[model samples]
Target: MDWAKDGRDWPNNEHSRFVACRPHRWHVQAAGEGPVLLLLHGAGGATQSFRDLLPLLARRFTVVAPDLPGQGFTSLGTRQRCGLAPMAEDIARLCEENGWRPHHIVGHSAGGAIALQLALHWPVKSVVCLNGALGTFEGLAGWLFPVLAKLLAMNPLVPRLFARLSSTEKRVSDLLASTGSQIDPRGVGLYRRLVADRAHVEGTLLMMAQWRVEGLMSRLDRISAPVLFLTAENDRSVPPATSVLAAAKVQDGEIVELPGLGHLAHEEAPERVAEEILAFIDRIETKKPPKVSGGS
Candidate 1:
């Protein structure tokens, strides 16, 4: 699939594995051997977003990260399938097919929203959101953004032209820079490749067009699983207040604020991000008592 290859320069090509998920061919990276921990990247990103944190996380628990539909190496399905609910359902299906009952679900940006959906729809122990997109747009943007995105995705030529026009290394770097996150060269390189690909760009456009969060936000209390919102102090894409407010609404939500980092905290400082996650997981596990022999 074109999503898996950009003229022989696939993102995280070495660890890539393909699975036939209906509607899309999934490219996943699985490692470690303990309880399941699913890592989900944001829109326009693949498994490589977790390149640094995965190995560290793998030491304590099994880690699985997959490219979302229409992004990374996953093939784009219909527009309907790209909507928030369907995207979550499809991910759940993928997990069911692979026998991965995520003991913990962690997501970045848009992926965090999906984690919430998974918690609501599946049996999950806990959820972690890294600068999650949990708020609705405001004023004219609330209406204009999705409208423009839908128009672009519907036009076959627009994505191709946009990819061609904005796929340069400088452009990719600038875009990443705008997020206030200082990504290393390697991380920026991966995004550079993604911007150059028409399929990936199209998939991103479709995702934006179908992205909806108001309904999910309205029912945040329905998410029974405990949640951890990790907010980067310098995040320019999604404000830290967004996470602070989101954490307040969930039944069991905790907020941790980190300074000197941006939206891509995992990418910028994997060690710090992984440290918090490990501690959070350990705390949750420690709270559980051991199984008693022959006890009710």
Candidate 2:
């Protein structure tokens, strides 16, 4: 996406910055001050996905939200790195280079998988997943979805064709509705801008084609950080049972259901989501052994 044209009215525009992290130039937005909290949006979404949630979380923590490589304002270097493991590794390096040690991670959908992958190596205190796409497709979908995505990604003309077809306001609204979420006009507008851009569309397709969740699911027990799977009852994109089953595998995982909400639960009700996150973090802190001072 063109920052000059498309990002003119971007949410939290003042906090946005471009950082060259080798192989990719990342666009990250940081605000407030305290322990770092990294916010990762799902595939096809940008930093704007956290426009409301970021400020609320920033009230108590240093919040950092970045557009994944090849999506949003971030330019992609290696197209193949859009996969789960590589994305996590690249993000870890990005954080280390920028001196941002995330005390906690809050990821939406596919971002949730990346968060778990990061926790495998990074020492984050906790992780929160909002309507995470934690499970693979069942039966025929499991075999067909990735294959179809790969074929689409391989076609150079597909992105432009998709962007053209999906650029209308009605189309964007329909797409969001398909997720069983009803967002405001502003939210719809942002998504429209994304779909209007061929690069964003291509990047999203590439990520979808390369994404693999089985590896992460198999190693959930290895993650030491406490994880909270915030599932939305009305979510049509990913069933709430996905989180229910995935949480059972984590050594320190818990599941919370958001009633009457959908796949984009955070966007639908940022305040409520923030409350759950803050409450979860508080619980984690309270469980920690208190610090002891040495005698002078």
Candidate 3:
């Protein structure tokens, strides 16, 4: 995550800035001039994930996309704070300190879970999840994934080894393919650069090790903001049904499926994903009761 070495040609680099938010130095990208729209990328991803989607959304709203602590260019403050609740709390603090009140929150995968957690405390207009990882793994994977991640995260050498092993174009392509998504060469290159960085890989492992959604899922019913879950039809990472079931629990939640897409639907079809998010937010705004003023 060296800005000079790795971020010279980064997507939307013009909008990138570093802010000293306690416990971490946040790398944030902000643009446009309307209501604040917060974009959160999934695990193992960075602001680059929204390369195309950001521009589309920026045209209509002021968009802010930040690299999660310890991931991308954001330096990690505390290892334990990589979990869902702590991440949400830290992000909330980041926003408050910077005077950015997110009117709408759009999150992908693990980011979606974090968005929901934020909604429980923050008064956001709506929550849009693109293939959110809202449910626990079924059967054996339920317990094994976290345990495996914990072991890898505990070992200091695993990340370096993983980075070295996954430093090829084919390796990155295959990894993305496993999620049932296909992206252009530039996208693949960005992912390759990320996986090749030991720090980024380590951050992703720490996040996976500490992530848990049970508490957040239990409180879905409490979120006053409308929640829109966008599930990709061909997603292989988290099943489409996960969103369906999670949406059912929320006070005002709905699900939309992106046909022929995958776990990385936003990257695969940024236009389509942007359209859904814009449409959803527009509907929410239109439904709100108009402001009342007292006549003098």
Highest lDDT among the candidates is held by which one? Answer: 3
**Model 1 lDDT, residue 22, Cα:** 84
Q: Note the residue pairs that clash in candidate 3.
A: none
Better of 1 and 2 by TM-score: 2
Query: Residue 107 in candidate 2 has what lDDT?
Result: 96
* lDDT score of residue 36 within candidate 1: 92
| Candidate 1, position 82, lDDT | 82
1 or 3, greater by TM-score = 3
Task: Give the Cα-based TM-score of candidate 1 against the true structure.
Answer: 0.90
Ranking by TM-score: 3, 2, 1
Candidate 1 least-lDDT 10 residues: 287-296
lDDT of candidate 2 over 73-113, digit per residue (tens): 99998888989999999999999999999999999998988
Candidate 3 residues 97-179, lDDT tens each? 99999999999999999999999999999999888988764333345456658678567888888789987999888878878
lDDT value, residue 253 of candidate 2: 81
The TM-score obtained by model 2 is: 0.93
Q: Which stretches of candidate 3 lie over 4 Å from their true place?
A: 137-148, 288-296
Clash number by candidate, in order: 1, 0, 0
lDDT (0 to 1) per candidate = 0.81, 0.87, 0.88
